[model samples]
Target: MQRTAAPRQIAESLTELWSPRIIGELDDSYVKVAKVHGTLGWHSHDNEDELFFILKGQLRLEMAAETVTLSEGEMFVVPKGVQHNPVAEAECLILLIERKTTLHTGNVVTEHTRSLAEQLRSV
Candidate 1:
């Protein structure tokens, strides 16, 4: 058996820009924290939905139909296979709930997706 405390610290002690920390994981799902700036590329998860919860600052979610702005304490879910991009005008903190096998950016294979494997960890 394993035990961990609530409110885990996910960001690395020295990382800057797009650092994701694993706060908690259970069964087939996990929670992650990320410090984000700039724009993430358009992508989608083929087999899973992604839930994004804004923790601090603001974020803009762009889809083919419309762009939605989420503030602190707000949240949005991107359905499976629905292309979307997340952008932040400034540094923002967000919590992501997703499946353990879900890729950060689907099959795009861009620089952003390259580090996804390293970003995930057991909490």
Candidate 2:
């Protein structure tokens, strides 16, 4: 069976904050959708770059050098080894494309951080 991925609809259905639901996969990456509010701590992936696409609301990707603001329909790529924190003033719906081995919050493990096992759980 060929299943289609509806990012916006899946995002709107999400009830948890900063918890990403896997929707699809391409080669070595996993396509994930998440509803986020506030911040997700500061961290970095030493070996993988992360791509973020905003599906609704707004987001601020704060890196050590500068902060990049993303609105609906916008996307940004956080290069590998750059420390960053994702913050949202209002609730946000987003799609994340990351490597299969990428950690939820990278090296920083906080209460909000979701493990790979948790991220892999059925939504």
Candidate 3:
């Protein structure tokens, strides 16, 4: 079915924290939305770059070298193999663009790590 997805709507539908739900797909990539708070563990995707677009609240990206802050309407791309952690002091909504093969937590498996099967489920 052809339809339009609202990131905020998708995000609001999420019941789990830090869990991403697939909203759409584009070629080899999947478009996901998540409602996140607190911190996500540091990890790196060996072969896929991750794109993060903030749809609400604030986000802080902590990398090995520096930290980047993103507010609503901002976006950032973490290059492949770059280790980084994401933190949100308050509730934040984000849209993620990642390859279909990209792991939820990259090389590190944390309690928050989600399987592709989990992400693909209806929100």
Off-target runs (Cα >4 Å) in candidate 3 are none
Per-model TM-score on C-alpha atoms? 0.84, 0.96, 0.97
Worst 10 residues of 2 by lDDT: 1-10
Pairs of residues clashing in candidate 1 = none
Model 1 score (lDDT): 0.78
Tell me the TM-score of model 3: 0.97
Root-mean-square deviation of every model: 2.7, 1.0, 0.9
lDDT of 3 by residue, 78-100 (tens): 99999999999999999999999
lDDT of 3 at 119: 94
Task: Order the candidates by TM-score, highest first.
Answer: 3, 2, 1
lDDT of 2 by residue, 20-86 (tens): 9888889999999999999999999999999999999999999989999999999999999999999
lDDT of each: 0.78, 0.93, 0.94
Per residue, candidate 1 scores C-alpha lDDT tens digits across 1-123 of 665543324432315556566677778988788778998889989999999888788999999988989998899999898999999999887888989888877888766663555665442
Once model 2 is optimally superposed onto the true structure by TM-score, how far is the C-alpha of residue 50 displaced, in angstroms?
0.2
Prediction 2 TM-score vs. true: 0.96
Best-fitting candidate, scored by lDDT: 3
